[model samples]
Target chain A: MHKLYMGNRQKAPGQQFITPSSHSVQFYEDPEVFLEQLAGFAGAAVGAGGCYLVLATAEHRCSLQQRLARRAIDLRMAAAGNRFIALDAREVLTTFMVEGWPNRERFFASLEPQLLRARSARLRPDAPLSAFGEMVALLWEDGHREAAVHLEQLWNELLGRHSFSLLCAYPIACFAHDSRDDLFARVCREHTEVMPTEGYTALQSDAERLRLVSTLQQEAAVVRAVVEERERAIAQRRHAEEKLWRSEEFVRRIIESGVDCVMILDPQGRLEYISPSGQQALEISNLSNFLGRSWVEFWKDEDRPRVEAALAAARAGGIGSFQGDCSTPQGTRKFWDERITPVRGNDGQVEQLIAVARDLTELRQAQQIAVQAEKLAAAGRMAATIAHEINNPLEAVTNFIYLARTTPDMPEEAARHLEVADRELTRVAQIAQKTLGFYRDTSKDKWLHVRELVEDVLLIYERKMRNKQITAEVSVDPELRIYFKQGELRQVLSNLLVNAIDACASGGRIWLRAHASTDWSEGGEDGVRFTIADNGAGMSPEVQKRIFVPFFTTKANVGTGIGLWVSKSLLEQHGGSLRFRSRQGSPSGTVMSFFVPGNANLQVHELPRSA
Target chain B: MAFLSRLLAARAPAREAFPSFSDGPPVSAVRRPHVLVVDDETLIADSVAAILNRNGYDAVARYSGLAAIEYLEKKRPDIVVTDVMLPDLDGVHVALTVRKVLPQTRVVLFSGHVSTTQLLELNSAAANSFELLSKPVHPAQLLKALQPAD
Candidate 1:
C-alpha cells in the first residue's frame, strides 16, 4: 500500500493514492504546503525504484529539486540513470500547443517521449512513474481557460495508455473571479482525485473542520445581511438626490421664464445671484460685472437712500418694499415695484435676501393714460356746456343786431356800423361752432388742409398768444393736407401750440411751419410734417429726458403733466411720432417736430377715432 | 318793399293792440298764418313773436312749453316754433304732443346746445316730423323755415 503524505501527519482517504495510472489534482494557495506534498509524492516514487518527472515553473522546479536533494535522492545520479526529469512548464506547453489549444497528436508527440524515457529508466519495467505538471495552471493563468481544461482531459486520456501516476496542480488564485466557479467544478470533475487548498485540508480532525465550516457559514450570512442593508441605504440616498434634483430643475425653470426679475443678495446686501429674467430686466449683458456689487447702487442717487433702507430692513429679517425709478446700463429709465424678503437659515437668522421686481413702467403709463383721458373728457364736457350757454346770449344779440339793421329808417353810416357788428358776431359764432365741433363728430376721419388746421388751432390760442405778446410766424403750404382722425390731430396740435405759447415769454418769437413731406421713416409715405419752434427759455437736459414720461411736468400746477405724453401717445396711435430738441444756452430754443401720414385709412380701425 | 312799408305802418298800432287777438276772425280779408313761438327765455319768445307779426303772420308768444301747449288747446296754429331745451318740458316732448293734438300743425325746434341734435335724431318720429335749427337763428332763416311747404 502507498501512503500519500499530508502536511499535518494525516492520511488521505483511499490507499494507493499515487499508484500507477492514477490522476490527481491539487488546489493550493500556500507554496510551502504544496511543495511539501509534492516532495512526499516524488520522494516515495524515487525510493520505490520508480521514475519521477516534474513540469513546473522555474521557481517551483528549482525549489522541488532542492527539496529532493535534501532528501538525499541524488538527483544527478538519478538523471544519469533516467529516473528524475525536470522541465519548465511553459516550455513544455509550447511544444504541444497548436494555436493556443493542445492537439491530441501533438500532446502525445511532445510528452510520450519524455514519459517512455522515464518509464524505461525505472529500476523495473513495472515500477510506478509519477509526474507532476503545472502546465494547466500556466494556461489558466494566461487566460486560455478552455485550453487548460482541455489539457486536463488529454492528460486523463494519456494516463490510460501510460503506466504513470499524473498530478496536476493549480494556484487557488486562478479561480478568483466569481464566474470561474463553474470552471473550478469542471476542473475538479476531470480528475479522479481532487484536493482542496490548505485552508480545508490542513484541519487536524473532521470535527474541527466541521465546526470551522459552520462558523464560516454563519459569518457569510451576517455579511450578506449587512451588504443588503448598505445597498438599501445607498438606494434611498440616490432616490432622495434624484427628487431634490428634479425639484431644483422645476424651480430653475420658473425663475428663468418668469417676467418678474428675481435676485438673491448676500446678507451683506451684495448681489449673489440674478435669475435670467432679472439679467434682462436690468439690461446686464454680463452677470459677472453686476455680481458682488451692492444692490442699492443700481438705483438713482436720489432713490438710493430708500433702496438702502429697504435692503437693510430685509437683512434684519424683515420684509421691505418700494416703488422707484432706476436706469439701465443703456440709460433707459425704468420704474420697478420691488419687494425684498429675508431668506433665513435653520437658526432663524437672516442668511440671504430675495428681491422680486415687477416692471411698473408700462403699468404706470397705462394708469396715466386713463387719468389723462378722464381729464380730457371732463374738459370736453365743460367746453360743450360753456359753448351751449354762450350760444343763447349770442343768438339774442345777433337777433337784435339783425332787427336794428332792418329798421325802417336808418343812416348809412349807422347801418354800416351795425353791419360791421353783425359780421363780428358771426366770427364769434364761428368760434363757438368750432369749440362745439371738438366734442361733436368725434369719430370722423377727414382730410384737413394744413393751413386750415393751423389757423383753427391758432385762432383758439390767438388771444393767449396775444396776451403774452408772443409773435408767431406761420409758414405752411396752403394745400398740405392729412387724412386722419380730426379730433385727435386737433388735440395734438392744440397741445403743442398751447405748450409753445406757455413756454414763450412776452415779446418771444414762435415759428410754426408746415410742409408736404414724405415720412422717410415709414418708407417714404406722403405726409405732412409740422415744426413748432419757440424762442423761449429752453428746457434743461433733465427735463428733456423725461419729456415723454407721463406725469412728468415742469409747469407746476397749471399744466396737466400728461399733455405732451397724451399727445405723443395719440400721434403714435396714428403711426406717427413726435420729437423735440432743446438747449438752454444763449439763443436757446425748443423745436418740436411731428409728422402725420397722408393716408390713414389702414389705421382707422386700430384706434378709437376720438380724443 | 310795399309789404315792408305796410308792416311798418301797422307796427305802432300792432304794438298797442298786442295780445288782443279777436279769437273769431281777422278784420282784414287776407288770412294770416297763426304762429306759436315757445321759449323759456321771455326775450327770445317775445322777439320771435314780434318778428313773425312784422312779417305778416299772426304770431303769439309763450314763455313756457306748458303755456304753449295750453295755448295750442285753444287755437291750433299753422306752426309751432319752440326752443328744444326748456324749463318744464323739452321741445321734443312738446313737438310730439303737438303731432298728437294738431296733426296739421308743423313744429320747428331750435336748441342752443348741439346735444339736442343727437337727442332729436335718436327719436326717429320727432327727427322726421320736426326740423331742428341751431340757435342764434337768423330772422330770415326762421321765416324761411316757417313758410308754407307749397
Candidate 2:
C-alpha cells in the first residue's frame, strides 16, 4: 500500500532522514471535508512540534479553527508558540499581485521575511515545516488560469528555497464546470506532489482510500467534458464578434466616403451623429460643430419652417422631405434635397431620425436654364401667331385708308396728307413680317420684268394718285427682266414709288423708268436699274445724308422711320444699291435709282417657263 | 378702259358730296339699295359699311352671324357682304342662311386668307351661290361688283 504523504514528519536535525519537500493540491466537494483534511495535515504537523502555514478562504479558515478546537488542539497556544499560521488568501494575493499578476519582487519583498522566520522557528529540535496555500486555486476559480499556474510555479520555488512541505487546494465544484487538460497538466508539473483532498490524510483501509481516489478520477473526467464545451462556446463567440466588427467597419466606410451628408437626429430634433462625409459636405472641420445643435438651424431662415415641419413628421415615425437653398461653410449657397426617416426603438416609439441630404444646386440651376430656353422658344412660336393675328387688323386699316382716299373732291392738302399716311402704313406690314422671321420674305424668289412690277405698284396706288389728280408715267422696255426675290424687290419698289408719289404735289407728274446700266464706277454689273422721279419736292443735303439712318423720318406722324433703312438693307442683300440725285429749286425733283446685280447664285437653275 | 370710266362715272357724285363720308351733309330721301356687311372685326365691317353708304348704297354693319341674322329679320338687303371667317357661323353658312331666307339677297364672300378663297372655289357649287372678293378689297371693286353691270 502507498503511504499517505502527510506533512507530519519528525526529522531530527543533523540526522540522515528523508523529509517531505513536495507540494500538494487537494480537491474537495464538501467545505466541511476540506476543512477537516486541512486541519488533519496542519494539526498533525503541530502535534509533532513542526510549523504549518495555511493560506485559505475565510470560510475554510473559520471551519479549520472549529475542527482544530474540536480535536482539542489549542490554536491560541499553537499560534503563541509559532507552530501554525493562518492567512486570508485574498488579502495575501493583493500583497503579492502587481497589476493583476503575481510579481516576483512584490511577493518576495512582502512575504520572504515571514517565510524565513517560519522556517527558522524550531519549536521542536527534530520537527519539519509544512504549509497549505489556496491562492492558486482562488485565481483559477476566477478564470485567471494562467495566473494561477504562474503562482503555483512561484510556490514551488518558495518550497525549494525554504525546505518546507507545500499543499494547495481548489473546490472540486469549480473544475466541474471547466476542465482544461493543459492547465491541469501544467499545474501538476509545477508541483512536487499532487493529491486528492482525502488522499493527503491517514485513512483506515487501502480499499477505502482507493474508492475515494476513484471517485476523484471520475470527477476529473466530467470536468474535462465541461471544458471542451466551454472552449467551443468561446470560439463561436469570437467568430461572431469578428463578423459584427467587419459589418460595422463596412457601414462606416460607406458613410465616410459618400458625397452626401448623412446625419442622425434625436426625436427632439437635436443633432446626434454626423458621418465623416457629413462634416466634409458641410465644410466644417469637426462633427461637434454641428452635433447637439438644433437640426433645423442648418437651413436658411426661409426654409426653417419647412425643416421644422419635416422634423415634426419624422418624430411621429413618418417619412418627410425638404428641398431649399442654404449657405454652406464654403461661402456659397447650395440647394440640398433632404430626406428624413424615423428610426424606431424596441418599444416602437420614434427614437431618432436619419437624414440624407443630397446637394442639388447644379441640378436646380440646369433646370432653371432649361425653363428659360423653353420660354424663349415659346416666345418665338408666339411671334409667328402674333404676326398672323396682326395682319387682320392691318388689312382693315389698309382698306380704311383706301376708302378715305377715294372720298373724292377732297382738298389738295388733305389729299397729300393721306398719301403720306398710306406710305407709312406699309411700314407696319414690313415690321410684322420681320418679327415672324426676317428670312420669311426671301423664301419666294422669281424672275419678273421690271416694267410689270412697276405697273403692279402703280395699280396699288392708282386710287390715291387719281384722288389728287397726280399724273404718273412708266417708261420701261418690256424686256427689262430682273432675277430677284419678287416679293422683297416689289416691296422695295413699292416703298420708293410711294415715297415718290408722296413727294409729288397736286397735278404734279411722277415718272417710273427702268433700263439696263453698265456703270463700272458705280459697281457696274449687267443688272436692271429702275428710276423713280418725282417733280414735287426734293430733300436738302442734310436730309439726304441721314435718310439711310434707321428711324430717320421726315414726315413726323406719317413716315415709318424704317422704310429707307429697310429698303437699303434689302437692296444690299441682293447685291444691289439704292442711289439718288435731288435738286432743291423750281421744278425740284428727287430721282431714286436701284440697281440689281447680274444674277449668279440668284439665277434659278430650274427648267424655265414650261409652256 | 370702259370699266374704269363706268366706275369713275358712277362714283362722281361722292367726289362732289363733301369733306368726308361720315361728316357729309344730308342727301336726298330716296333710300338707295340696302346692303348688310358682316365681319368679325368691328372696324372692318363698320368702315366697309360707311364706304358703301358714301357710294349711294344704304349699308348696315354686323360683327357676327347672329347680329346679321337679327338685322336680316327686319329687312332683306340687296346684298350681304360677310367676311369668310366670322366669329359665329362663317360667311359660307351666313350666305346660305341669307339665300335660304331672302332669295334675292346677293351674297359676297370676302376673306383675307387665300386658302379660304381657294377652298371655296374648289366647291364650285357653293362658289356659284355667292360673289367672292379677296381682302383688302378697295371700295371701287366692291361698288363695281355691286353695280348692275351699268
Candidate 3:
C-alpha cells in the first residue's frame, strides 16, 4: 500500500548519516535508517545533499505544492540541526529536471513500465498493492517454480522504488537486498524493511523498531506544538502594537486641539512637540522648523535665561511660570502669561516639559484706556471747581452794573460810562456763563427762542462789530423754535457767534439765519436749524477738519480752541447736532449750522420781564 | 426812654441786634450749625465767609488751620470745616490731629479735585470722625450741608 503524504511534513528528530563504506552496519535494525538512506539517494540523484519525505494514508493532499516544499525544507533543516538547505522536487519537476533532457527519458521509462505492470496486476483478484503482492514479488524472485514462471514476463515491468515495500511479506528474501552488492543499500533495507515482530523474543531480542518509530512521531508532534505557540505570541504582540498606536493618536489629538500654544520639550530643552496652535501663535509658515530645535534658539536672547530657569524648576517638580517680553514681527510683544508644567513618567522621572502661552496684547491696551479715562475725569473735576469760583462774583457784578445803569438823572457821559460798564460786565458775565455751561452737570431742558438767544449773544460782539464795521444780519423764521437748557443753548449760540465775529476782519458780513429744516444735511430730521455765517478769512482744508476738536483753533489769542468743542458738546446734550462748511479763499466765509429738535414749545418757562 | 434807648442802641450793632462778630451765639445753641471759614486767599475764603455769614450762622475768618484751631479752642464750633490743601498741615492730617485734641468736633474736609473716596478710608476712623466736601462749593449747596439736624 502507498503511504499517504500529509499536507505538512513531520520533521525527524535528528539526521544520522551512513554513507557507502562508512557506518553501514549500525542501521541494520532500524527503519529510520532506511528512510534517511532513501532520502540521501534521492538527494544524490538530484545533485543535492538534503531531502525530506512525508508519508500519510493517501487522503490528505489539501496544501499547495509550494506550501509542501516549504514544509519539506523546514523538516529537513530541523533534522539537520537547523543547518541544511533542502532541494525542492516540485521546483525541479516544473523547471530544468523535466525539460528536454536524457534524464527525463530514463525517468519516464523507469516509472511508466512500473506503473503499467501495477495496473495489470491490480486487474487480477488480489488486494491492490497489498502484502500479498509483496509475497508474490519475493516468491517470484526466489526461484519458486510456479511463481517464477507465472511472474517472469511482468517482473521487470512491475519493479518500483515504492513497490519495494512488498518484500516485507517475504521476510526471508528481504535479507538478500540488505546484504547486497551495494553496502549503503543493504544497510538501508535492513534498517527500515525488517519487520519488528520477526525478532528473537518479545523483550530481550532486537525488537525496538516500533518503539523508535513511536519516539520519532512524538518528537514531530512536539515541534508542531511549538510552532502553534509562537503564532499565538505573534498575534498578541500585534494587538499590543495596535493599542500603543491608538494611545499615541489620542495624545496627539488633544495637543492639536488646544487653543493656546502648547509646546513640549525634552529634559535637555530640545523641542519634542509643537501643537498646531503654536504655528498660529508664532505666525510661522512651516511647522517642521519649530520641532526638534532648542527652545532657547527660537526665544529672544533676553527671554532665554528666564525660560530656562522656569523649565528647570518645573522639571524639579517645583511649579514655575515665565513672563517675558517676546519680540514678534508685529511689535515688541509682551507674553505676560506662559506656564511650564513637568510631564512625569511612571518611574517618577521628568520625561518632558509642556509650555502653554496666551497672548495678552488686548489686556494691556484696555488698561491704558482706563488710565486715560481717569486722567480726563480728574481734569474735568478741576475745570468744574474753577468755573464755580468765577460764576459767583460774576453774577454779583452783572447785578451791580444793571442797578447802576438804572439810577435817575445820571449825566449823559456818566450814563454812557455806566452803559459801557454794563456792556463789559455782560461780556465778562458771558465768559463766566459759557465756562460754567461747559463744565456743568446737564440735567433738565427748557424752551428758548432762537431770535432772542441770538440777540443776547450778539450784545457781546457790539464793540467788535462797531470796530470791524461787520454787517450783522439777523433773519429768524417766526415759526422756528428749539428745546434745550436755556443757559446751555445760549452758550452754544454765543460760542458760534463769537467764532463768526472773530473769523471776520474789518468790514465782513455776519449772517445769522434761523429756520426749521426737515431736510438738514440731506437726510436728518425735522428740527429748528440755526446757521451762523461770516464773510471772513475762511479756514484752510486742514483747519476745517480739526475745527471741532478740543483745543484746536486758528485765531492767535482770541480762540480758546475749546469754544467750538464745548459748543458741540452742549448742542449734543440737547439732542441736537452742529456742522460747519467753509470756502477757502475767494468770497471766503465760514457757515455753521445747529439743528435742534423742535420740541421746545412744550418746555417753555416764562422769563421775568424788566419794568 | 432816652438813656435806656441810647444804651440799647450802643450795645446793638447795625446788621442784627447783638450783631456780634465776637462772642456770638455758641454754635451748639444754633439748630443749624456754622463752619468758621479759614483760607489765605481772601477773595476765595472771604467769599465763602460772606456766603456763610449771609446764611444766618456766625462765621469767623482765619488764614490757617492753626488760627482756626486757636479760635476753636476759645469757641467750640459744632463742626470744623477746612480745605484739605491747607497752608498749615494737610486737611487729612489736620483732621487726624484735631481728632486727637477735639474728638467731639465733626470735621468737614474739602479739596479741589480729590474725591472723598480717594482721600479717606471711609469705613474706618475717617468716616466715623469726619466727612469730605468737594470745592469750589456753591453757596447754596454749602449752606444746605451746614443746616443742622433737629
Highest TM-score scorer: 1
Candidates 1 and 2 compared by DockQ, better number: 1
Clashes (N, CA, C under 3 Å) per candidate:
0, 0, 7
Model 1, A477-581: lDDT tens digits are 665566878788888888898888888889998999987667788887767788999988999998998888777888888987888888898888878889999
Best by lDDT: 1
Tens digit per residue, CA lDDT, model 3, A1-611: 21111211132312222221111111124333333433433233222332222221112112222343443533333334311223232332223222322143444553344334433433232212311122222333443424322332232233333332112223333444332134323323333233332231133323354565577589768966876687779899998988999899988887787767788889888888767876676776676866788876767787888888888898898766877767553454556567989889999999988888776655765565456557656766666676556644554344334333433455788779978886776566565444443435334565556677777677656777889888899997543456666666777787888888888988888999887666345355566778999998888898988888655678757665677887787778656789888997798999999877665333322222221
Residue runs of model 2 more than 4 Å from their true location after superposition: A1-20, A123-125, A141-145, A176-184, A197-420, A423-430, A433-611, B1-150
The residue ranges of model 3 lying beyond 4 angstroms of the native Cα positions read A1-327, A331-335, A338-355, A380-385, A402-421, A439-611, B1-150
lDDT by residue for model 1 over B1-150, one digit each (tens)?
A: 554334333432233223345774454654677999898887677667767776668888898878988999999898999999999988888998999999888889998876786687687654455788988787778878877767
Ranking by TM-score: 1, 2, 3
- The 10-residue segment with the lowest total lDDT in model 1 chain A: A1-10
Q: Tens-digit lDDT track for model 2 on A1-611?
A: 22344433232322211264767676666777677766877777777777777788898888898888988899899887777788898999999898779999888776677676666664765676877888998999888888999998887777667677777887767665443356777776776555545444555567876886788789868876877788899999999999999999898898888988899989888999988777776777866667798888778899999998888888887888999887877776788999999999899999889999998977886676467557646876676457557767876777667666765676788878877886677655544544343223355556776677777677667777998788998888765667778767777887898888888889888898887665475565667778889997799998989888655788889885667777888889877888899888986999998887757423322323222
Each model's fnat? 0.41, 0.24, 0.00
- Between the candidate structures 2 and 3, which one is better when assessed by TM-score? 2
Candidate rank order under DockQ: 1, 2, 3
- Output the lDDT of residue A388, model 1: 81
Go through the candidates in order and give each one's C-alpha lDDT.
0.81, 0.74, 0.55
